[model samples]
Target chain A: MALTDRCDIFGSVHEKGINRIVRHLMRQRPSLFNYGTAFFLRNPNLLCERIQAAPEVLQAHDPLLSVQDPVPILGAAIPLGLNWCLQFTDLQIDFHPGNVFHLPNELGNLPAQRLALRMRGCFGLDCPSEEFIREILPQVEAEEVAQRGKEVFGTKERQPAAPEREPIVLPTRKLQCLCVELFAVLHFEWGTIPGNPQQWLKLRLDGLEIVDLGPAPLEEMAECYIRAVLKLGILPRLSVPIEAMVLNITELMRKQGLAIGETITLQPTPVPAGVPNNPAVEDDRLKAFINLVVEV
Target chain B: MAHFTLAVSEGTFRRSFDLLKRNLRFSKSDQASFGIFVAGYDVRAHLEGGTLDLRADNTISVRELDIRWDRLRFTLGINIPEICVGGGCINMPWPIPDICLPRVCVFSGNPDISISPDLAAFVAQEVSFTGRVVARYFDASVPPPLPDLCAPIRIEPLPDHNQWHIHIDPQTIDVDLFDFPDIVGNLIENTLSNAVRAIIPGGFVRDIILAIIGGIADFIRFLLDIPDEIDEWLSDLFNVSFGLLDFIGTLVLDFFSTCNPIYRIDDPFELLPASNGLIPVRIPLRNLSVRVNDAEMVAEVDIGG
Candidate 1:
């Protein structure tokens, strides 16, 4: 109906991300009507969490079984941010905390694939006792709901905490366990691509310029960092109402030829070990790099 | 004018390219390949010089030049249309190197004016290509090198909603990871080095370290942290330690690419993201995307009298 435009709403139903909230308000009479007008006024943060968790509440359709979730909102937020990047001619965002992740209120970058997102530990603001979790939990689908929450959050808890990242020799805290001297770390560069049937994963932890909290399993320690970075952090997603033009620094590096072909990539020599045999990459020729760099 | 003719498809850009790809040794900077043919010329005369030209200029322009004595020659080139001033075949290696080269000169008028005393040379060139190049002559004349029929860059492209995911082969990974000793050594060395010397001032380090160690034990992680290359750093610091040259030389043939696979992407506009999780997408560029940078190459030889 409108003239040709540079922007388009993805669909009518998902209007700039407010439809879901509108539906939530319709169900529970405005806190002004039921809980008391003053109740909604008491806690602004609580009110926001409720509004954000509306879609989760409406879809599950079980009020007595109420729970607060921040995952999908985080996921949705990612696409929205990425869309913002798309609208710009040059979008440059550093791979830093808050800029790229939404961590739990506390704890980050844990090694486990299943994580809890809340101010307190495992459960959200109001968690059932361990006893209740044990009794009513196994009987129902809370685990399933919990998992859905995890994917939305785009990260998991750090199980097994401090991962002995390397066969390190201890400097201070010595673990008699055969864990060599090392630091615990988790690489956030993990991603799943669509249409890849084989579903193979190439693990890389190099080039992060990672911080060392000292000798532990890097996988576990990395979680702490991820959590730190992702805490209430912005999740990377693809959304519209804006644009989805995420300027991946890595891809840019690849474009600038900073992403050199791995020696194995070229030779495909097939290291019996499987890691691409990366011959030392000559740093980008200063001349070539300078010529193409308008602004990085 | 001496002329040679080579047949190509009606619009045979790909075929002509395939022929070049199959026939030469690669050069890095200019992305060209060089191959040679003596051409029924009498090399028996050593008193005069000769010129190298693509008699078939309308059809083929020289991309690489190979000039050598009895038998020491190096050449690899390509014919990128942007740089081809097709009619400049006045002399072999003309307007180039500005030296007495072993090549025959072609004068739109008379051919003998340009002269050199000790020269015997050959001419070779290539052309631009499209589609799947079906190589007709990649012979043993070139040294054995790695092959990549499928391009690897542009493996991960994020188009609107859909993304290009370059998948790695797990089997290939497992075999490659466990088999290479240097890689394993690198891992073990880094791990071992990292395992030691961590100071936990108070419970912070101890607790965090223990927790991190637990996570690593639980998560099954792989991290390769090679210390920053200090050779250049050290060299820079010392200045005399080869850093002064700051020279990074690559082989005549180099593979400056990675393992990520390349494919096209479709904009999976999110409005109707798969409720069932199956989304439809189209590969934008059905054909592969490859980048080869071979511009101009220079060889240096100084004779001081």
Candidate 2:
């Protein structure tokens, strides 16, 4: 092993003895030994040496040699000369035992469920308490704005002093037929009849009475009920006929000269009864979770 | 004085942080009642290159943040039988290349790092990051520029351990794309207004007026193209930034919140030797201050609390 280590075959593997034997074999039997001599002359060890010399080719095969993936190699080779902020003498932070609030061991295994739901074009408002104002109203407003944009480009109220008396209007045709579904889930913790928990909820859209799913029964023990249905009078029908109907309505009001680019609002409102004037959301025992969704 | 402080090198942090990679995929199928049907959606993002650096003044810098998306693919079906609009589903897939946000630097600028001792944790100072974020939709040649992001991280220490557990509160990363409407409108007006007028061939005053109004409609439609699913996806994707800010911000908090034991000193409760042959002592740590250098930080504290 020591002799093998000392005898270094640096670049070309064609040693003196090996080269002499290969030449003698080729000369003795020209046709038969020519291929064998050539194979021996083009040694695999020499090929390896050549590959080691050409780093780009080697890197193409082995990502460890490539610059794009140098983390594995550089991480081991280079030290991370991190200059810390604190000195060796003053690195300690005061550990105040009183700072930590230890929870009871019984509560450690409390079942906490986690759910991730991805909803599209649905506005959800969640608050620690009911006192937190309608936080999801802004989302509703944004939805309203998006619906309004679909109707027209925008109203351009030209100045009175300008040559044109009327504003520049860009009118758009609504989708031929469409139906929207409004869904809501209510979780009532209390304030309802225990045997038969029933409640009335009303929903309105675009100044049109959508639906009032009269009275729905709730489950027991923090009862949760899901109530979903088509909007009230505007059933799933041909939107072309609906458009013509709207046009007839517009014709009746034509004397007023229904201006172009006028916005048609689609506002959604939910009213759930059986709660105090202002439900105290902070009271965990008397809490309710209401989630509203509008699918168009 | 009972004190202990530990110093973790940048290499040590990198070695410890080598296990944060996973495949993320999402698919959703929605058939809306409003003449819109999406058969299926496949969104994939593969995180490739990642490197971390612990900077001075409690800052963590990531040099390479590359995310390669397989494709933003979906099949859209619009069902409106009336007005010659029949119901049919077409495969609409987006071919988006990789997005690399290089050298994303995040640091705590605010000096007020609030500590909730009751929770055994500290709310990291409002962490801010500098990185160029872009959100491009299918068929959109140019993506929208994202605003800078800033947020806070809650960092807590683990008992009997030298490391601190860092949690990213996603609610804190605030990036608003409310100006998208304004941007789209401006783009349409600038690029289309003159072109529309040129094509209309109207020299008369009345004709010119008609041309202007007609052109605005075309511009609005082009601007509001792909409003439903693709627009929402781009907006949501950009809004989250692949949780890069959250991940890197947590690293910064972890580095800053680490209570390493550099030196451990015993604390004697009393001034004299105790009856059990133990000295009663206390280490008074006082006058704590931290100063930042270009690439280094120097902290000084007295032996008195």
Candidate 3:
């Protein structure tokens, strides 16, 4: 389908659409102090096809919130997994990055809101208990995330003697389908050159490089333009012209006895070659950042 | 005395083998401290399109391995615009070989693995690994698969069974200068004179061919043996090591330690009294063996008291 056709379908979700969903959610839940219209719509391109309810929508709507407020609130709802994209977008939220907002009545009341709150916490929250969190987030664990983060992004100074949280014990079968996605945006900087300088852009997964796009002229240095679609599944496919490298990782996962819900942190970096491996030099020549997104 | 034995079926073995074959991919690298260039070149080889079999005779073999590299090559520093398309280093005159490899096949005897006292940990059996080099040249005019290059090179695995270690002894590896087809040899001799091949005494093209073939074999050995290294490390770390004097002292100490046991359990021949007001028991270990079959590995222990 054409791009506009897809947008229109989502655009026609309602006369008010996502905006209305967000305002209604705000009026219903007072704990959800902040949210946006786009928050509920992931793959804005697929806007109408898959409309997700926001976390606040899943929370208990305090009728008091609507009555206590002087101004009328709008409506919107985002699905649980939608929180993953928040780190990449300009949309703002009051909560800290990677923190899951849960219902205060999560454990006490055990209502339908508990399931919604649990699902949200499963994907994004670093909640305290595993038994409660595992109900919705079957594939990933917060402790594992923290441990993996320390191992991948840790420095000697940053390394801790022990983990601050308890490690989640995982069964063998679920560990077999471990998958992780790494998203990186590399900014290129040329020294005094006006036009796009030629350089190789390399993306290495787990220290092994799967693709290198370069020797081609770069368009601009002002923005981070390079993005990678990491394909980690039973049958691994690295799309082309990069398709020359056809790798199937399912066997390796089995050999390592990886569980289905296990997380594999892919620490990949993209850089212009031949540059000195100095911090000062690299800071000037290029800057790279990464986000690790995982699923069961 | 007590003894036990276990058996495995061919079906289980095949299932395990298929699972292993499916998982043989180089998804990511364990070495990251290395630079991007090094890491990028560390490509993985998989039997993407191939057939394998495991026999009931306790043997596993791969009939074919259609290897394709996991990464595409693009010029890093070169600025020639003619070769640049969509910013990829293509259409270039220079041979920018894929760091890992291109498409190829392994046509050889069925390779097998066996566990025996006479062999080092693991070694390739009955298989003479031979590769068909398939390098894609951008220009159609360039005739592919030079005549002399058609010969399949030999890949040998020399095992150090006595030392309990195996090494890819490519030190004696050689390439026959006359083996190259005359046309192929002449082109390579002249073309490589100006490049990195210029440093080698013989034909540079010939050396590169040897290197590629040897490198592939070496990589296979690495893939097979890397897991063993972890076990070896663990065993070395835990297995006690002692100097000559320490060993003798320990032996004497153990002898003394065993003599003062409080009680004893004897065979029909004799009965001993408790010395330290506690009964001592002696259990005889008659035998221990690890037997591996097509489906399972059984560890049997025979004990007698």
Question: What lDDT tens digits, residue by residue, belong to model 2 across residues B185-241?
Answer: 445554565665677666676466656755775466446534422432443345433
Give the local distance difference test score of model 2.
Answer: 0.28
> Looking at candidate 3, what is the lDDT of residue B255?
38
Cα RMSD for predicted model 2: 46.3
Question: In model 3, which runs have C-alpha deviations exceeding 4 angstroms?
Answer: A1-296, B28-44, B49-62, B65-67, B72-286, B290-299
Q: Where does model 1 exceed 4 Å of error?
A: A1-122, A125-296, B1-265, B268-305
TM-score for each of the candidates:
0.18, 0.18, 0.18
Q: For residues A1-296, write the lDDT of model 3, one tens digit per residue.
A: 21111111100111112222333333333223322222222222221212232343334222111111111111211112212111111111111111222223212322210111111101111112456446636434554565567668755356555443322322111111111222221221223222634332322221111122232343121112321233243112321221122122333465676432333232212222321221111211111122122223
Instruction: DockQ each candidate and list the results.
Output: 0.01, 0.00, 0.01
lDDT of 1 at B208: 69
User: Model 1: per-residue lDDT, tens digit, B1-305?
Assistant: 00111111121223223332333232222122223211111222111111112121121222212221232233322322232223332334745653443444333322212222322222211111111111111222454335542244334332334333322111100011121222343344446436643543455666666566555533332222111123423432343223222222111001212233233223221222222222321112111122111211111111111
